[model samples]
Target: MAKKKSGKQPIIGICALCKKESTLEESHIVPKFVFRYLNAHSFTGRIRTVAEPNRPLQDGKKLHLLCSDCEDLFNKDETLFSNKVFHPFKKNGFDGPVIYNGDWLNRFITSVNWRVLHQDLQKITTEQDNDKPLTPEILNTLSNAENVMRSYLLKERLNLDVLENHIILFNEEIMRELFSHPHAIIQGSAFGTPVIMNKDAMYVISNLVGILVITIIKKHPEEIWLNSFVSNESGEIPQSQHFDSPIVTELRKFEDFRQAYIEGISKNQLEKLQEKIRKDPDGFKNSETYKRIMMDRKLK
Candidate 1:
């Protein structure tokens, strides 16, 4: 018998969501459109990730987690969301509360949250060093949440039983609170990640530019998440919502990280950015970034 060559095998395995054995696709956990939006509106047409502040990122995180069929399933809802809620809110100047059919909205929210949760679980399993180690009970809860979310995404379940989805609009009120750290808020507006609060809470928060999609996996009673809860039936994403939760503190920490990144930006990069603005002063003044800066200044 011929000796088998030993090398790293291709990522040909089962789809995480669908669980079908096939060649997996490089799937994006955070929708790719989010990165496009960030680049389009950014001053230099470049965006940086929270993990690598100094490195210019062309896309969001991706893994070989899904097959093409499963990927397409996600794309349908993502397109609906981007066209209706996301683009309208971010680009076309339509502010909430925007009405949406429960079907697409629920799928979209579930898809994003499921992807985040799924990826996090994989990370925890493969990597030994966890900042906040999951207790057996918490781990089991997360595993169950992931399974339910997957079933919901795959249309196997009619609803996410105990799971809750919410959209918090970045309107005048929330913007006011975040005004002091304009850079942080601006960066955050384009970011997406999971927010795990030890044994007390767990959430996957996606900032679709100005709109925040928060998937509540678990929560403590004291954590007040009001008005924004997305129902399974048709609902409206309200202009105003309240979040008195540890998630707010997590957001602040993210803002601080962004702030530190901004401060640590090399002088050469700043000069280059300034030069670019100088070359097209009129464009710079009229850009959305400049408007945000002015908004921050006025609020401060």
Candidate 2:
């Protein structure tokens, strides 16, 4: 048996494809919508999808991770190496921000693991090969490859879809500038509410950042500290879930969250609302729901 390499030298285990973490978007190891059923309100007390590294979405969080490239290229069966991809260095060690993540050469070399890596390759090639079923011998070969390399899952493999509706890319600007091999943090908007660093929907950015974290790191100054923040911004969608939905026990009143939403509403209306709040804190404070939120915030 080959000895497994273990170290704390910042080598990316989760992120293995890209070099630039900045360019590398937060790839979800698991889908976010799945959490909706499990946790709809306040992250169910698990990672709340803050887009910031340290903050958890709500409470109980469960998700498998996926990088951007893996999600985009393979999830959709898109072809890699077809277009010119960027790299920080050709083969030598570098001083500036590297392009892709984690010893790409080494990753490819180490990816000889048959079960995980080979299966992906087979699944992908199978599509092109008329969806041919794997031969018993080949299937057997792919069944056991854990020993070869724990990090052997390749970006471009065959039929590699974990669950449908998987996300590929969450961000791009940072990915191209940073190496995706190291642990990273990303921020974006999902469904509606702001997210700073995300791991629930990263597949399109490429499997660059080994450790991808997404959250709505920064938003309007009024909606800071998060617990008061709402993940859903869509109001037109039927508002049926109760304040005490099983997924979220601590649901903020809809009225309290109105200012935070401006996507679908008119700008003039939003400005008027904002002006009202700014001009008359007392009037805003007098609202029954706002009073309740304040009381909760004080207690929480």
Candidate 3:
């Protein structure tokens, strides 16, 4: 019999909303386009180097082990956003500022702040118990964060049209080639909310963008897996087609999109980015604009 090469199911945590035990896929802290600028010209198995962003980006692999349903929801949004904004921007080198989902991103980011509160609570309370038991408060903290990230994605990952206009913007004309995925949701009372993407959906996107930049700078990586899946001893079955959606599959296979981004962003773009930073100041940190997104903020 052939032996398995994969690791013990990537400890994908439970989806906070659904409370399912699963692997949390590796999600990017920043989008791929940002990094791609620093990388090579394209994903054509080539690599370039840059100095401004310091070192080369990672192998353009920003992942977060997530269950089928959560992955599906987020990827759906990714496809929509990529086609409308990212793809055009990367291909044409369209100069502009970062776009976002205003209310939803900010609201959910608050939950990440709560996670810190929960952690602090555990730290302070854990000393009191010789054998610390998982308490409701701790659970609430994590759950709160997860719900914030997962619940409002549709609100956050839209283009300016849907965002400013508050429209659904669901179209079938550009469905393009379909992708593969499975049908899965969170189960078992979750430890907390499942939030791979913070209030600013960019947390994941920026990192991927950065890595893609890195790939262009250094060299393109071999593979780019989007919310990959696996089975386990706990009745988990290995599947790829999340809900059997073609859109979902296309998202999972976007190695070139990431590579193109690296080649696309120009030095001129960086200058403008700096100007935006100066204008915004704290706004960037508060907004999804920051490439390295930190989830721990003060919960309101």
Write the candidate numbers in order of decreasing TM-score.
1, 3, 2
Q: What RMSD does each model have against the real structure?
A: 4.2, 21.0, 20.3
Q: What TM-score number comes out for model 3?
A: 0.31
Ten-residue segment with the worst summed lDDT in candidate 1? 179-188
Q: What TM-score, over all chains together, does every model reach?
A: 0.88, 0.19, 0.31
Prediction 2 TM-score vs. true: 0.19
The digit string of per-residue lDDT tens for model 2 on 1-300 reads 998788533323443343234233334323333233223322112333323323435432221223455545333211111111212111121223212222332232122112124335434445634554545544343333322233334433432223111111222332223322111122112221111122222111112212121121112223212111111111111111111111111112222233223234456645666786788777666553244345434432
Higher-lDDT candidate of 1 and 3: 1
**Which prediction has more favorable lDDT, 2 or 3?**
3
Off by over 4 Å in 1: 1-11, 92-96, 182-188
lDDT of 3 by residue, 1-300 (tens): 998887666655764434588766554333343344434332222232322222334444343534666555445445544564445544443333224442332322222223333333445455645575545654454444334434444345222221111111111111122211110000000012111222222111112231111001111133233222111111111222122222233334333443454466677765666787788677666542232123211111
Q: Between the candidate structures 1 and 3, which one is better when assessed by TM-score?
A: 1
Error of 3 at 75 (Å): 1.2
Top model number, lDDT: 1
Ranked by TM-score, the better of candidates 2 and 3 is 3
Q: After superposition, how far is residue 110 of candidate 1 from its true place, in Å?
A: 1.0
Best by TM-score: 1
